[model samples]
Target: MGGRLGGVGTGLALGGGLSYLAPQYGMACDSFKELEVVLPNGTITTASATSNPDLFFGLRGGGGNAFGIVTRYTVQSHPIGKFYAGTLVYVLDHSQAVLDAARDFIAYNTNPKASIMATYEVLTTPDVLLNLDKFIVVFLVYDGTEPGTAFRNFTQIPHLLDTSKPNKTYTEVAEMPIPYTAELSRADNVFRIGAHRIEGAAGLQRPRELYDRYAAWAAANKGLYVYVALNLYPVARSMTDASRARGGNAMQMPDGPWLWVRYILSTPPGLLPGVYDKVQASFRAMVEATPSAPGLPLFLNEAAADQRPLSTFPTYSRLQQIKRKYDPDGFFVNRTGGWTFD
Candidate 1:
């Protein structure tokens, strides 16, 4: 009924979504009612709309860098039941067909009763017996109490491997071990054109050529390439609406249907400049292929030094104002790669 997934908890603690409704009903962070913070000078403060309101608004989505230090976060709780969830892995040889199927699914998928996540990746391990390349797809469907119905809908896909189960808890699904790791340094590249949200027939257009190139690159760069994952999550319209009511941020992409095309390039420790250049080239090609590419919006927490400046969106301005009010001297700063506001 009510439980917090530690993995999700760790994610939120490290600047992921914290609102109970977020993981439960796809709610946004600003929906939460309160937050508890410790000031730079060791002053304990509790904030909400009624008390310490400024700090409360600031911490909602403002990058949690300089607002003293959040030792504990008291969040609103929600009741959720059993749901359907699992991952679908595909071989590298079927990458083209899989990508095509995924595009079609997202385009014609009108069912509001299901939530699906599609990820494409190439896995390679140099331990002699573990090296392989393939396209892995993960689908998580939250079908209220009807897990069977959700599983049936997904089974329609002619997938190489389908692993759908029933009665799975939200925490179990949220904490499901995805392929990538949090600690490992990754060379990530993303290219997105048009609006954030695509509507109707337009959302169905498949980027076939893009998939081909990605697959080819992954194949050629075998062992050193490590892994690649392309994730598409429907940012529920309700989530967007809630965020707007709570004083919006720059994350307003399109409002229709959007996919997160993520390319995770992990390399061996010793393989330096050569591997880095190749990965960089792959990213460049991807961007060049896009018509109106807006570069990449680096995640503040995962961003490197050069990537830090890309985080300066309209939301950053609002976050800064809030930060100045509560953390004037910049105390609890943990912005990845030296991000600061002086």
Candidate 2:
């Protein structure tokens, strides 16, 4: 939830934003009731189940700039009372155990109230799998004050830091792990996303393998990068049901219990143009080591511009229809940074 909050905007929410509460409710787009939008050719209109339904469908999870711009949103709001939540940090030595616990949590955690995100941070180069160059940061949240056995797997681990509190405000929970500051904003950050199905025990190995390969890439590209991260997000069955109950969105997410990995790489601030391309080529190769498991839609909230997320949605054809109707002149397509319609 580190980058998901601090302040969620129209783009983030419409682009399938997620949260600790997602397990209980659903993605941010599922909360929409109505939106007032400005179309490519300057028409002003409203979108919702009752009005402009096609536009509503495409705008929900099809949130790249290809769609019309939303000027106002009327969304569903939930109670944000105190909850049991906080951050947990572990050293590289405990990386395997921590990752194992995370995988098990994803596979077996059935509580809708319990949601968590695990991020393995590679802060330096020359990271040899089990060295001090890496560490893990996890954010845990339970809707109620008593998590019961929900967090035992993490608590059992001997960690370097634990900032969890039984009673935490919504704002406090959003800021756990780290606060979003100008320094972080200014970093040359690029994110690639991976989606994998949680098929029995394969789920356990997939995350671990992805993280290992990512670390290897970082080690091989020593000076080209400053920091790298692999953040794991669990999509629960309850979450999928919630989404469907809300009329479903453009992503057409299949039944849940799937995984979305956010791969972040921060290159040096000012690399020469040619060198930058090499770094990008290497990063692309590293991401290809584990492609998304065929059907899941890549997330736009954190995905790189070139990921072409729209094409992966099950409702791709429907979205295309919506695009042509809304922007017959291809105005948004020509001027904005959004998913390609073709």
Strongest candidate by TM-score: 2
Model 1 compared with the native: what TM-score? 0.73
Highest lDDT scorer: 2
- Tell how far residue 276 is off in model 2, in angstroms: 1.2
Give Cα-based local distance difference scores for all models: 0.52, 0.82
lDDT of 2 by residue, 1-342 (tens): 223467655678778879788887788888889999988878889999999999998888788467787899898988777899888889877878888888788778899999988988776546555566777888888998999999899989999888888888887877664522214747577889989876867666887788789878877777777777888898888888888998988887888888899888887777898998998988988898788998899987878878888888889899999888888888876687657686
Q: Which residue pairs collide in model 2, if any?
A: none
lDDT of 1 by residue, 1-342 (tens): 111233434324323242324323333345556666777667898877888776766555444555666666665555567866677766555555655565555554445556666666666643244334455665656657564443443455556666567788776766655666313655343332222223454335434555666666666666665465544444455544555665543343234344444444555556678767876676546534533224323333333344343244445676578767776666656433244554
Each prediction's number of clashing residue pairs: 4, 0
Candidate 2 residue 5 C-alpha distance from true site, Å: 2.0
Clashes of 2: 0
Per-prediction TM-score to the true structure, in the order listed: 0.73, 0.94
